[model samples]
Target chain A: MDHKEFIRGGTALSEDEIKSGKIFVEEDALDCRYAWDTGVAIGRYLAELKKGKIIAKKTNCCDRIMIPPRMFCELCYRPSGAWTYVQDTGVVNTFSISNIYYDASRVPSGEPNPMPAVIEIDGASKGMGIMHLLGEVKPEDVKIGMKVKAVWKPESERTGSITDIEYFKPY
Target chain B: MRKVAVVGAGMTKFARRALETPKELSYQASKAALDSAGMKLKDIDCVAHGSAPDAFDGIHQKGEYLADGCGGWNKPTMRVFVGGATGVHAIAHGWYHVASGLADTCLVVCEEKMSSAMPHAQAFFLTIFDAITERALGLNLIWIFALEMKRYMERYGYTKEDMALSAMKNKNQGLKHPASQFYGGNELTVEDILNSEVMASPVSRLDVSPVSDGAAAIVLASERTARRLTDKPVWIEGVGWCLDTAYWATRDLYYPRYTEIAARKAYKMAGIREPHKEINIAEPYDPFGYKQLHHMEGLLLSPKGKTVELLRDGHFDMDGNLPMCPSGGLLGVGNPIAAAGTLKLCELFWQLRGEAGERQVPGNPRLGVAQAWGDLMQVSSVVVMGINNA
Candidate 1:
């Protein structure tokens, strides 16, 4: 409610009478930095990804293999039971080919237009999937239930992270 | 009226961003609460969901969106909103559902994802101002809180070090909390806080709680269901709330009149006269350092203008007579808005049940109080809790 904090500041940049022979514009880079925790389920999943394998948690009660694993199973209010490996190969549940970046900048024709997709991995419960980028395929070619496999970095380059899997492409 | 008691509590590790979707966060916290109560979604007769400022999550009608995650699928569900007070208010909302014989059990869930807001969550706070008179002012929470801190300091002659102590105490207490999602392990000193970069005069960067994305939930049940659920139940002894005028400019910045009124109503329902002597612990919403002292006075836990003296004497520490923010409160645990507010009540539940683990205070503390303030410094929500009082 106090207007004094806003009004008592330096001169506005657009003033015709420039102060100190400079037009100093205020820079309010309001973007904030965030470090998100993956928790135990995703934490272990990422570790498995570093080893060139996909992992999921087996729910104790519902007996479903959950993707992007977590500590507790939402279905039955029970802690997840087992860490089971899943096939790198998956079937595309859905997809979208984006020709622009998040900020609406055009994706240059020289570079690959990112094809983001929901890929339902084999061995996971039906329709249990992850959203990832699809590569090595054309926009018109990618269709529902199209089989795809993860493209991984060399073992030496693996850093125990999600990016270990470069992208998914039709095998 | 049927008696209601909290039988279980749970929370996710707070962080700058949860990385998981808001629904997933709600699911985790809700699952934990239900698991702690040895129950399932089917056992919950209703749900009370709370979130503050849709701008934080960037989703409208988030309550309905989160209903299934909160175990409210096809069940009676209510969404509560009142800015920062949504946490305590939602719990009270659930309490009434059980207290009014409308439900045998209610699951209260609160979540916030401030990191989803672009630029910064503070940007959304700017929109909460009075449009015609205040929107063009470009003010943020820090600016307003700084003004209030200045008023309190000038009135009581309190120094920065005096305010800094609250931050110091809470941060140290946070080390024991695994869910203290924002802060890394650091035992802070008052001098470290006072010397930190000043956001506004008397309000340093360390004075404020970090923006966080997380969720918390608690399970409430009627006396019959409560007895069958757990050996120990924390009774909801009292619940009260009040909203003052949004014309914060006209109100005195030195005190929160609404919180006092809210506390009085809660105290009367709980049948308490001497809150300072009766209540063993308190969590009074410390999103800022001085606010701990400011709200301590407002909650009537500390004499007006003398909170600094008690703070200086280590009266609000873990081993002190009355441990405030023993769950590290919001300043240390990270404030995910509604989730953090609900976490305060969850802290009281855990403490009263002797289940606080590393953060447990001595003396087998029984009675406790939690208060949340929000919305242009106008709204206050208060809840009094106890054990063996049912």
Candidate 2:
């Protein structure tokens, strides 16, 4: 049996077809809002970040210190033992130098390429990291295992969010 | 457990922009699948629908909206989701419906109208990130793949040229696929890919699959129902799906442990210890050029850091030792997320039954595997299928 005979062509709508209302189109925006609870662990972690400090949740079951602190241990499934302050310094786990914007449009010429990295925080277990932007260095200079420090906003400008640390830079 | 087989499969031509609404696309594929099975909507006992986020379609509760089109007016219906894994997972759900003795016949449908999210389909992709932590950093979906591609290349010592082979081969194969969105039937060289404009570093425009609007469907039935319906039934030998933690940052990006676990589960159920020797053809998801290699490693089809070598040696070519992506895959066929993954299963169904016309691999291919990876590099869904020679 010819599979081609079973497959059907999709209806392609041209701009004129839509404009002439030959093809009906609905116009609306998704205006959904979400106010997610930060929960105990992340809430406290955010509070510490607002004070210009990086904190992690420590688990007694194992010596693992989890960044972006969680209330429960993922491996042991037990409540985290305590909150430990980790250094703002970290090593880049992996990085990307993107010339495209979020919507996939090309970034304008002469603008700095956005460099994002998964930086494994110092004093945390191996590979315990968070996603953030990189700054204060050329895109070419960013390397895996490159030591970096958080570039925090001014104390007055700090918000209780991950943006509290503006970005990470070469320490 | 009872046996389940795929009696029929269908897919619409993938396009960048489709005039049909999400429901219409679902109806087209579902009706074609039913027609291929020589069955009617009234004959189906249940409907299993799979789609990605409702944000892309701009319709909330998209499953409920797509129900009637998929022949779920009064039948037992369910929607399965696991990011991009939803398509294969939906088929797994249909298999369960038949194998569990709850239903004798089931219809599995997957649809994605990425063009509906105007300006760009990627805008909806941004919401998949962590709300409190990752989103504020101004990260986009491409960044994660770029980072992983960089890591995979660095760890394996593979080059962009090595990855481009997949892009070139898949696109060349797409020439034969009628449902492919980018099927210009043109040949592309590695230089063509290397010279393509860079979207993310190490990931050029050619490295990624195009966002597409499409739908695909398959009809599944129990042993008795399948025997009655068709002489050439493709059996669903095994199914597996696994997900890693949402804390994607902490894990190593070079290899997909979740895909390994999922493949292992499926292989165990299929009673196959060695996938490389046992599985004849493989359709590992290839949204990006390197991802085919990444998932091949995860599927244990190739050893760690060995896929590129095999690829360069023509091991994974359509006529090579182990043919990969004989249906052109997402890179050539177009990627409508959930729908694209389901399309892989359709290819396997066609290939196992020797029904795949121009894209059919040489040799009487008896067994094949289709796998999908999604959700921030977390989930993996796999299905092993074979012809019912008995």
Q: Which prediction has the highest DockQ against the true structure? A: 2
Q: How closely does chain A match the true chain A in each prediction, as TM-score?
A: 0.80, 0.91
Candidate 2 structure quality by residue, lDDT tens digits, B1-390: 899999999989998888887888999999989999999999999999999998887778998999998889899999988878888888988899999999999999999889878889886778889888888876777888999998899898889898888788887787788898656667878899889999888899998888889999999999999999999989999999998999999999999999999999999999999899999999999999999999999999999999988998999987887999998999988999999899999999888888899888889898999999887779999999999554
TM-score of each: 0.69, 0.98
Native interface contact recovery, all models: 0.00, 0.75
CAPRI-style quality class for the chain A–B interface of candidate 1: incorrect
List model 1 lDDT by residue over B194-305, tens digit each: 8886554556778888888888899999999999988898999999999986645445667998999999999999999999999999999889989988989989999999
Clash counts for the predictions, in order:
1, 0
Best model per lDDT: 2
**lDDT measured at residue A170 in model 2 versus the true structure, 0 to 100:** 97
